[model samples]
Target: MLKFFPEEIEFKVPQVMKTTKWIKSISESNGYKLGELNYILCSDDYLLEVNKQYLDHDYYTDIITFDNSEEEDKLEGDVFVSVDRVRDNAESLNVPFETEFRRVLIHGLLHLMGYEDSTDELKLQMRAKEDECLMLF
Candidate 1:
């Protein structure tokens, strides 16, 4: 199941058509069955606060994933996305809003699948996997 929890603020996200498809594809490709996936769209301020509080980082980030997967076959997580950052990143990356938005969503799912981006090489691999997953959309 997939659930959306929009914050008090509203930001247009077109429709989550491709986003849903891409998420399912990524989860399946990683050999896990998705259970409950929660999406929270919030302002940059809210996400930044989460980053600082939970991650001990003071910088703004596009997305953060809180993995709650209990078993190898089950996939579960809370994907917190910053609509503000996504919009700006889309413009900077020269991609459509939906495309960049989906990228960030897949990035979070990748984390739940045990992918990391803490190092330069890992970030490159993660980006490659993200591109591969995006192409499947």
Candidate 2:
């Protein structure tokens, strides 16, 4: 199941039904099944606290994913998105909020699919994958 909630923020994902279906399709295309995936939208401060508490990091990020999947083919986790960061990133990147939002949304799922971006080459690959996935959306 996929769910979205607001934490310390009053916001709703636009075109929610379409978004959910798109996310599900992305997971299915990768040969994985969705299992209790939750997205929590929050402000930068809220996400910062979560980062400090859970990740031991003191920086703001667009999204944070905690993989909780026990089964091999099931994707389960909590994805916390910082709306403040997304909005700023959208403006900085000169893209629509919804577009950047979708990019970040799928970025978390890509991580669950075993894609990493710690290296320059991996980051390029991840960006290419994200672009391809955005086209699907």
Candidate 3:
């Protein structure tokens, strides 16, 4: 299951059903079944607080995912996204807002899929996989 929530923000997620289907395909294609996933869209300040309160990091990030997987065969997590950061990143990256937003959304899913970006090599792999997943949508 996937749920979307807005926290101190008014952003609306486009094509909910289509996006859910795409997320499921991403999970299944990666050899894991989809589980509960929550997307909390919020302002950058809210996300920064979450970063500090939950992750002990005092920085602004596009998305922060909390893994809640209980089974080896399933993917479950809460993905908190900063709409403010997304918009800024879109403008900085010179891409459409939806495009960058979707990428960040899937980037959280990728984290739930046991993908990491702690190193340069892992970041490269993650980006490549993100591109491939985006092509599917």
Count of residue pairs whose backbone atoms collide, per candidate: 0, 0, 0
Candidate 2 lDDT, tens digit per residue, 10-94? 9999899999999999999999999999999999999999999999999999999999999989999999999999999999999
Q: Rank the candidates by TM-score, best first.
A: 2, 3, 1
Q: Show the colliding residue pairs in model 3.
A: none
In angstroms, the error of model 2 at 131 is: 0.7
Ranking by lDDT: 2, 3, 1
lDDT of 3 at 96: 92
Measured on C-alpha atoms, candidate 2 has an lDDT of: 0.95
lDDT of 3 at 32: 92
Q: Is candidate 2 or candidate 3 better by TM-score?
A: 2
List where candidate 2 sits over 4 angstroms from the true fold: none
What is the Cα-based lDDT of residue 101 in candidate 1?
86
**RMSD after CA superposition, every candidate:** 1.4, 0.6, 0.8
Between candidates 1 and 2, the one scoring higher on lDDT is 2
What would the TM-score be for candidate 2 when compared with the true structure? Answer: 0.98
Instruction: Say which prediction, candidate 2 or candidate 3, comes out ahead on lDDT.
Output: 2
Q: For candidate 3, lDDT tens digit of each residue in 86-123? A: 99999999999988888999999999888899999999
**Each candidate: what lDDT?**
0.87, 0.95, 0.92
lDDT of 1 by residue, 6-120 (tens): 8867865556665676677778877889889998999999999999999999999889899998988888989999999999999998999888988888898889899999999
lDDT of the structure predicted as candidate 1: 0.87
